[model samples]
Target: MVASRSQVADVAANAFRRSCLMARISTKEELRRIIAEPRPATRVKILDSLDEQSIEFLKRCPFALVGTTSADGTVEVSPKGDEPGFIRVEDPKTLLIPERVGNNLAFGLNNILDTGEIGIIALVPATGETLRISGTAEIHDDPELVASLSSLGKPALLATRVRIKHCYFHCARSIVRAKLWDPKAWPAPGRISFGKIIAPRIGESEAVAAQIDANVEGAYTTRLWQNT
Candidate 1:
């Protein structure tokens, strides 16, 4: 007699459930015993009181990763970058970041508007060190602020101003392992334009693909990195 398909599936499911149960620790005490001891907090220096060094680090950082969470608890981390010193450190507890043209999804910005809680990690490539700042963010379209940041002739849409809660320097272990700053270790693959990648997925014809390729390439070479 041969086992039916449903019987085979049921047997497999039961085995998986049994395996999961066996893998789980029986109690909180068991979990605590199995886990490693927590690290001491002595190494972490609080940023509630910032000094000139922390302020200077924020000012010199050209790129940052902005993390936000929505009311429904959906998390989003997005990269924001521009010419050096794009993020203006208004004071020890405040920072201003310009919002440039993107896909307009505004997922990160929208999350900030809803929850206000934000986390930022600033990276200075040459130094291989990073700084993390966490706090609240507000979207601002102030005319004076926009005008000041747009000195390079590009128009600003909005600026994200953050009220920092805590700031700290992250270790360089990950960067060292990845060899991120070593150009010799970089992978050189065939260059593909963003238009080429999206055209097929979006069902665009050959003519439309060429048009998009030109448009996207022009915008980047002309406006986005013009200052650099």
Candidate 2:
């Protein structure tokens, strides 16, 4: 006998619950029992504001991962990239990230508006170490600042200014282990199909999905610095 759709969903939900409940660590003591403690220097390395080394690091960073959380507890990590120095160092304690054109979801932007909290991991290409920063953030639409962040001659719609609270250089163990900077260790590239993923949910046909795929590819070239 075949199971109903609801019945199959119930079975899957039960399995997920069981997996979540298995071997869960509920407290710090339980967590510490398994993972080793950080070294003394690790605790002291976090700075309240950017130091000279960190400021220099930011100057060469062309990419960063911006993390934010909404009031409803949803977390969003958006990748932002541009030419080196896309992010401006307003001062030792503040950073300006230019908002670029992309999918209009605005998940990260909305989260900053709701919570004012943000985290960022600045990365430079061909390097393993990453700079991690956490702080309060605010969305700004100041005309002069936005214009300064323009890329390809198109001005940014807005910017996120972060006030530094904690800043540190994260170790490169993860990157080194993954050989992230080594082209020789890279795996074959994979393709993502937004059409295939969204078609069923939106009640669309394969033709619509194909159009979506084509539009998405077209946007990569036409919409990088401007709206389509």
Candidate 3:
């Protein structure tokens, strides 16, 4: 007797589940078996400090993702952006990121205080390549240093200084694959309703959510450079 359509569907679903379970490699050896090793040149490309090329790259980079970890090993990543070259390369071995107006949660900042380690991936708009740097970091509030990192005629309240330990240019394959700079291939933008997210969790009404969203948008426009 021929299998019914439902039986056939059930068989296929079970096969997919089995394949997924079998595809997971739990050991490094199993992982290495399927993935090729990096080329020797790739292995040696990490640098201890920023080179001339790296410094020039920073001159055009306006955005970066900063990564930090807390004492309990929780990780936090924060996005920072400003005019090109907003991040100052204090020297070949050091760099600084000024703190700007933001929500006071301070998860990433507090993580930096708990664990001095930091990693950053700096990117330039419309460019596929990115620069990756990992190093030790310290939060600084020196008046002169903070003033030097200012933007829009307003000095930064604090700066995170990184002592570079490893620096490298990441290949552009990931960006190319994601089509990040290709506006033609982009999907429609989606709205982020912070009020909808927060209000429901707190058992608040739609009116409260609307008020929260209005406050968020107001802050975005008025408080970017300084607190309103």
Candidate 4:
């Protein structure tokens, strides 16, 4: 005898329910064994001071993510980029990074002002290695420093001076897993057009997307020539 569509659906659902009920249930200890494991301390040596290796890595890095926390406990991470070697190492413990044109929200800078504690992860795309630095940051608008970073007569808006506390070389596990530097693994440019994705959420039109794209391209171009 053939069953109706509703009857067939009910029969399939009952089979699924029985199968689920027959499956082995996990005890708390079994669950803990699967999920909880103590992390072994990484035995890599920490640099007592920023050495030539660290400085060279910082110089070649074109991008860094700055992490900061506010006194009230808000956290922010901001992306900073410029030409290669844009970050200057004044000394073993001191580094300077120029602040260029941004939206002026200053979320990361404000966090620095409130807490003084900051973390930085610098990445060199060509090589899969990354450097991590934890330190205190001071914001400066000194004309001399700003002028030194300016190019084609455009002055830097600000400069951040960081006093290094701990500097370490991070393993490439994350990069290797993500295939970050693999050209073949990159997402296609048109997969999700920036305009289509952002316009509605931002209440902006395609013009806004065009403007943002143009600004980013222009900034990157100008940054290459700036300080030349």
Better of 3 and 4 by lDDT: 3
What are the runs in model 4 whose C-alpha is more than 4 Å off?
Answer: 1-44, 151-153, 190-228
lDDT of each: 0.82, 0.92, 0.92, 0.82
Residue pairs clashing, model 3: none
Global Cα lDDT for candidate 2: 0.92
Candidate 2 C-alpha lDDT tens digits along 37-137: 99898899999999998999999999999999999999999999999988899999999999988888999999999999899999998878899999999
Compare candidates 1 and 2 on lDDT and give the better one. 2
Q: Which has the greatest TM-score?
A: 2
lDDT of 2 at 1: 96
Which model is ahead, 2 or 4, in terms of lDDT? 2
Q: Which window of 10 residues has the lowest lDDT sum in candidate 3?
A: 219-228
Candidate 1: tens digits of C-alpha lDDT, residues 61-80: 88889999999999999999
**TM match of model 4 to true structure:** 0.70
Q: Tell me each candidate's TM-score.
A: 0.80, 0.88, 0.88, 0.70
- Residues 40-158, candidate 3, lDDT per residue (tens digit)? 99989889999999999999999999999999999899999988998899999999999988887899999999989899999998888899999999999999989998888988889
* Tens digit of per-residue lDDT, candidate 4, span 9-92: 999999999998776466877667777753555434466458888999987888999999999999899998877877889899
